[model samples]
Target: MQVLFITGQNQYGVVSHFLDGMREDLESVGVRTDSLSVESEQHIHRDLPQLLPLQEYDQLISFNGMGLHLEQAELSVPQYLKQRPVWVFCVDHPMHILKRIIGLNVILLCVDEEHVSFAQLCGFNARLFPHAIGKQQLANTSMMPLEDKSNEVVFPVSYMDSGSHRQALTPYWSQIGHWVEQSRSVTRFMQFIGVLPIGNRPASLTLNEQILRLCVTVDSYLRAKQREACLHFFAQQNVNLTVIGRNSHCYQSIAPTHQYLNAMDFTDLQQKIAAARYVVHNSPGFERGLHERVIYPLALGTLVLTFETPYVNQTFPQVCLDAKQSSGQISDKEYQQRRKQAHQQIEQQHCWHHQLRKLFTSPTTSPDSNGRTR
Candidate 1:
């Protein structure tokens, strides 16, 4: 099989790393792969035609719908893309890219189960494709003894302050809060937003579209709040905390006592994880999915302290530390056992090769179905 990856610029430059890893893994399995780098929307119109006048590959894969948004006037581009199956691997919430992907003949491979449900609700074909640890990440990491690790806690995430989002979204907070309280899950919140009349809907968007946009905004705000809360909780305990990512200065106000460093590429981030005693993962919106952040640290022999989510509790109950609980209570022997179990599980089930096999072999689901593969 042959696959063409639609690559593009991302803020943190992690997407390129992911594509490179996937390419290596796919080739190892006898799948030929190519990539097209799109710098902007204009590049898509200009460069995509190069693939036209002939069918070249079995599949066209993109992350977060990067190069698939073809304009209606660009008949050739859309026609060319439609000839081959298009797959979008959504690493974040699907709602954020709903507008860009509306008319494309693309199947969504979501990292989270809730994301699949959200995409299906929006009338798209989606499947549950959980995040996995790349082979390169594993190859670069060496398990450090817990006592020998340098940092006590490391959080490698891009920071977004919730206060700004909260103030901007204040007008719709009461209604959004009410909907959130009634419907605890993101999928259900979207259902309510679709049917209920939102008086504060934006003038530019249709009712459903406007409400859905609000839901995305609200989700972002909540996620930011949750991250901030987690950071503050750790700082209050006076643990040796280190924050690494963009907007490191934001930590000054949020948690001044903690050490902060600007963002680095995925390669450097792996080094940081391999040295840390514990990695804190704050996944606020992903209730039924595991983030690569959670998996990478565990695979690197660093215990993960994250919020209690259904997927984490069920999959890595031995390794995950509930953000609400004290990590100091766990004995050294227990920690070693948990780390061993977590590493084995990731090696056995959550590696890139495992995901690639599932991606190629699994049957696609109907758009009307429940959007789950496992």
Candidate 2:
């Protein structure tokens, strides 16, 4: 079977790399693949008819919901999309783009299990599909002896302060904050938001749509808070730390002494991760999913020090640690063994070749049975 990847420009610049890796992996497994670049929503209206001949491709896959704005596109565009299976590989929380996806004939391949539940709640078809390590990540670095790797810790993260968002949602801060603090998991947070009353919602949006917008705002705020707290905790430890990614300088107040480098491309970031002894990661509101940030380092033979999430605690208990719990030192022998095990696990289950094969072979539900249509 052949698949067409619907791609577009994104701020993070990692989507293209992900598509490239997925295409290569799929091809290796004998699944033909191609790509369609839709620069914007207008392109979907103007270019899709002549460019996208659905018969040639058995399926269409989009990263982060790119080129799937059926709500805004011309009727013909959505009509074409409905003719075949369309799958969106959501790399972020589904709440962020739920409005655009509602009433569309598309399946959501979510990176987190909680995301799946959230989509299902909205009457959409969603699957739990975690991010996979690319071949480039593995090829960029070899497993060095634990003692030979530098003692430095590398954190590849983008810093965003949520102060403004909190201020903007001042009236709902108390309720939102309580939900964030009291909710044990993402699913619980969703349940809390579902009951929240937003009287000031615009007439153009339905209650559920307004609630989803609030959820996105609150989720971003919580992630910023968590990242700041993690950075402060690391600062107190006085270990050699390097922060890489966009807006690294914004972390000055939290981690003044730590080295900061501007964001680099994926390959360069992988090289930095490979040279480090440990990679520190903060989940962006994922309670039951592994981010590529957490997976790539492990695949490159570097130990990951991340917040204690359910998925991580269960899958990589050896590397899971919360702010209250110390990361604690590991002996070289133990470190090497952990790295070996992590690498083996990634190769077996978290590689693109394995994930794509499973996805393509799996049975899909009919759109009529999955959810409502526009």
Candidate 3:
């Protein structure tokens, strides 16, 4: 069946953009798909309220930022779905999903057992579709070593609101960050390896970070007498952090363990993230559930260092750490073990082969089955 990814990549579509790239992975496995970005094509604007690009899609996969106006706006989610069976994918906060569910046919979820308990309280069909790191680099472990890398660490920045980001991990950021700080020395990372940076500001209210800079200078200002101590420690250690994706956010003042590299396309971002020593991710917000940013790190076979989130615990339990307190800890051996486990799990459960298997084996597509959408 043909699937249409009806989405917006502008002002309101920041987080929504996370789920759109799955189309590439899906297509690699034989799924016919088209991604309709609200901010890209001129026709989308000319179509005026009628965003339907190519004709008849067997299914329309709606991301967040879709339906609140999903059904109301011009060339919006709701308008496109009315013509066919639309599955409202909800990996975001329950409140948003609940709002979109008002007239949607189905509420698709990327939930885990831990979160499902919470989902029950919100009263939506929060199911566990799980997320894959899009299969592109599931086995690309041949990464290059850095030169004179003082710190063998990687901290990719997120565009999430600084306040919401810290709040989500208030339960565990320091503890996790600290352990990561202590986990490696000069030998392990040899040099810090940061990954893709997005445009700070797009030409429009879009995802291009072409014009953004780090809030405080990324240099000494990044580590003052009383900021997150873990970050300060890295700076103090003279770490060599290589910023990727090349956003204008000049952390240049921070004297990051290293220099920023040239920009990369999204696919290269996946490859580089997979090659890094480790990636540090903040947890999802209270209202927003698991975000897809976390998975790419895991898929890359890079050990993940982030505030623990329920989704990660359920999917790649062995390949990560959940640092719950400012000073809590987990072992280097444990970290290593979990990292290996994450790699194995991705190969088994998260590869594109598995994705294709699920599609063909699902109720309607199964050989012995009657036609029905799961």
Winning model by lDDT: 1
Winner on TM-score between 2 and 3 is 2
Task: Give one digit per residue, the lDDT tens place, for model 2 in 1-374.
Answer: 77788777655567766887888788877878877667776765664665435556677787767766544323333655657547888888877776656777778989888778767756677887888865545555488666678888898888878687677668886767787777554455656665422245323423466676676666777777777777887887776579997988888877798888999988778778888988887785687887887887888888887754657767777654443475548788888888888887887777777667666674543343233222
Q: Measured by TM-score, how close is model 3 to the native structure?
A: 0.54
Model 1 TM-score is 0.83
Task: Estimate the lDDT of model 1.
Answer: 0.73
lDDT, candidate 3, 80-180, per-residue tens: 44444455455543333444554454444443443343343334344444555445545545433332212334555422233444344345444444432
**TM-score, one value per model:** 0.83, 0.84, 0.54
Off by over 4 Å in 3: 10-21, 40-55, 65-84, 97-101, 111-123, 136-142, 145-150, 159-275, 284-293, 308-317, 321-341, 352-360, 364-374
Ranking by lDDT: 1, 2, 3
Lowest summed lDDT window (length 10), candidate 1: 365-374
Candidates by TM-score, descending order:
2, 1, 3
For each candidate, what is the lDDT? 0.73, 0.72, 0.45
lDDT (Cα, tens digit) per residue for candidate 1, span 131-231 = 88767656666788878877558888778877787776778778677775465445556656564223454223243676766777777776777677777
Backbone clash count, each prediction separately? 0, 0, 28
In model 1, the runs with Cα more than 4 Å from the true position are 40-54, 70-77, 136-140, 145-147, 180-188, 191-207, 326-333, 363-374
The superposed Cα distance between candidate 2 and the true structure at residue 314, in angstroms, equals 1.3
